[model samples]
Target: MENIIKVKNLTFEYTSDEHTHRAIDDFNLNINEGEFVAIIGHNGSGKSTLSKNLNAILIPTQGDIVIDGMNTKEEKYLWDIRQTAGMVFQNPDNQIVATIVEEDVAFGCENLGVEPLEIRERVDSALKNVGMYELRERPPHLLSGGQKQRVAIAGIIAMRPKCIIFDEATAMLDPSGRQEVMNTIKRLNKEYNITVLMITHFMEEAVEADRVIVMEKGKKILEGKPREVFSHIDELKKIGLDVPYMTELSQLLNKDGIKIRTDILTVDEMVGELCQLK
Candidate 1:
């Protein structure tokens, strides 16, 4: 698979009133095409900052970010880079630009100068992709939180980005809303073959990803398949991060001498492990 995103020794800082704060410190990463990668971190850990840099919302103070072969630092590639990697922020309301759902979904395509017919096709397809086609004619403000977020996602997909960076996209939702967005995210990666870079605080959401990246104080401390990374329960806990519930429960069980598998990440895996003990 092609490397869609590459960050090399990237450093980013915010300067205010002559005081500089390093938000990302020599961070490096690579995400493959069609891969679903989740970034988890405590507040001020620089996950969101990294996402912005990847999308070229902020340039690197040092190092480079290459997205789909386009370097984000190059001024000429700014628009193309953004088109290649669209962003969906935490609040759906902030992303919705049109009054009606379908119009909002079509907004990105229109801005990209897609023809009228193609824009219509892309908007409808994007809405259907996020399971929001049935409500396309409704006012966005009337929809539930989950539906609104899906509309926001639809807008990004309509632009046909190769990769989507979701910056705490599900943070404002209830459990059901989060699940709705998660289902849409999985479908986007698995069926549509779109790469996903999700920065989220929810451990369950991270567990669903192909890989989990743990960050702390502007640096990546851990990166692996979800099971491999979450297996370090103590290390994650020390960093103010939580593993999937099943992984944590299994660890406790092993401590109590029950001898269950420590790598369990889901309910089904835990159930299977316990059944073997009987």
Candidate 2:
């Protein structure tokens, strides 16, 4: 697969009248096409900062970020870089701009100067992709949190970005709402072949990712498949992060001499392991 995102020695700083605080420190990463990657970290760990840099919303104070062959540092590639890597922030309300759902979905395409007919087609397809076609005529403000987030996602889909960076996109939602968005996100990656870079705090959400990345104090401390990364329960805990429920349970069982696999990441896997022992 092609490398859709590449970050080399990325360092970003937030400067104020008093002093400058570094948010990302010499961070490096690469995301291939159609990969579902999750980034998990504590509040001040720089995951959101990395997402912003990937989308070119925040330029790197040092080093470089290249998205789909376009360098984010180059002013000429700014719009192209953003189009290649769209962002969906934490709040759905902040992203919604139009009164109606379909109109909101059409906004991105319209800004890109898409023709009327093509824009209509993209809007319909994008809405259907997020399971929001039936509610396309409804007012966005009237929809539930999940529905609104799906509309926000449809807006990005209509623009047809190769990669989407979700910066704590499900943070404000209830459990049901988070599941709805997660389902849509997985479908977009598996069915539509869009690359996903999800910055989230939920360990359960990270379990669905193809790979998991753990960051701390502006640096990546861990990177592996879900099972591999979550297996280091102590390391994650020390960093103020939690492992998936099943992984933690499996670790506890192993500590009690029950001898279950320490790397189990899901409920089904845990159940199967216990059944095998019986």
Candidate 3:
């Protein structure tokens, strides 16, 4: 797989009157094209800061980040870089600018000078892609949390970004709302073949990813397949992160000689394990 994004010795810090706060240090990473990657860490672990720097929302104090061969620091390519790697933030209300859902979805393409007909087609296609086409004409403020987030995603999709970076976009949503957003992202990757870089606190969400990157105190402490990474139950706990619920249950069952796979993630997997035991 080709590399869609790369970070080399990335470091970022903020200067305060008392002292400098290191947000990221010597962090290096590579994301393959069309891969669904979940970045999990506790707040202030540098994941947020790193996501910002990916498309030049924040510049690194040291090191370089390149997206599709263009350096993020290049002033001329900033908009191009962002178009290639679109970002969806947490607040759905703040992201919905236009009153109508369809218009808001078309907003990005409008700014990009897409032809009117092309913009309309893009809007409809994007809404359909996120299963929000049914309510395309509805007012965004009236939508549910999950619906609003889906609208936000449709808006990004209209921009035709090769990769989408979601920065805790589902954090404030309820479980069902979170599942709605997660399913949208997973489908976008599995069906549409878009690269996904999701920064999330949800361990269950990470389990569906092609790979998981664990961050701690401004650095990359662990990176591996979901099964491989979640297997480090002790390390994850030490970093103030939780293992997936099924993984935890599987671990306890194993300890009690119930004999279950330690890497179990989904509810269906747990159900299968229990049935087999019976």
Candidate 4:
């Protein structure tokens, strides 16, 4: 797969009179085209900061970040990088600018100067993609948390970005709402082939990813397939991160000398392991 994003020796710092706070320190990463990667970390782990830099919302202090071969630091590539890697923030209210759902979805395309006719098509298609087309005329503020988030995603899709960086997009949503958003994300990656870089605190949400990256103190501490990374129950716990529930159950079974696989990440996998004992 082609590399859609590359981060080399990246460092980001916030300086004040009191002291300098480094949000990202010497972080290095690469994301392949059409890949679904979830990043997990506790507060102040630099995950959110890294996502901001990917879309050129925050410029790097020392290193370079290239998205789709466009360096984020270059002034000329700013809009291009942002267009290529759209962002969906934690709060849907913050992302929704227009009063109506369809208008909100078209906002990004309008900013891009897309033709009115094309914008209409994009808005309809994007809304349908996120399953929000039926409520096109509804006011955003009246929608449920999940519905609002879907509208926010449609807005990003209208921009036609190759990748979407979701910085805790589901954090404020209820479980049902989170599932709705997660399903939309999966469809976007699997059907539309959009690369997905999700920065989230939910361990269950991360389990569906193709790969998981663990961050701590502004550095990459672990990166691997979901099963492989979640297998490190102890290491993740040490950093105040939790593994998927199934993985935890498998680990407990192993600790009790039951001797099952430690990498089980889903309920189906646990059932399979238990059945294998017969």
Better of 1 and 4 by lDDT: 4
Over 4 Å off, model 2:
none
Which stretches of candidate 3 lie above 4 Å from their native place? none
My TM-score estimates for the predictions, one after another, are: 0.98, 0.98, 0.98, 0.97
Model 2, range 22-133, lDDT digits (tens) per residue? 9999999999999999999999999998998998889999999999998998999988887889999999999999999999999989889999999999999999999999
Positional deviation of 142 in candidate 1, in angstroms?
A: 0.6
For each candidate in the order shown, give its overall lDDT on alpha carbons: 0.94, 0.95, 0.94, 0.95
Model 2: lDDT of residue 246: 90
TM-score of 1: 0.98
**Measured by C-alpha RMSD in angstroms, how accurate is candidate 4?**
1.1
CA lDDT of 264 in candidate 1?
Answer: 91
Any idea what lDDT model 1 has? 0.94
Tens-place lDDT per residue, model 3, 1-278, is 88989999999999989999889999999998999999999998999999999979998899999998889988988999999999999899988899999999999999999999999999999999999999999999899999999999999999999999999999999999999999999999999989999999999899989999999999999999999999999999987899999999999989999987888988999998899885
Per-residue lDDT for 1-278 in model 1, tens only?
A: 78999999999999999799999999999999999999999999999999999999999999999999999988999989988999999999999989999999988888889999999999899998999999999999999999999999999999999999999999999999999999999999999899999999999999999999999999999999998999888899998888899988998899899998889999999889999996
- Tens-digit per-residue lDDT, 149-251, candidate 4: 9999999999999999999999999999999999999999999999999999999999999999999999999999998898788899998998899999987
What's the lDDT for residue 248 in model 1? 86
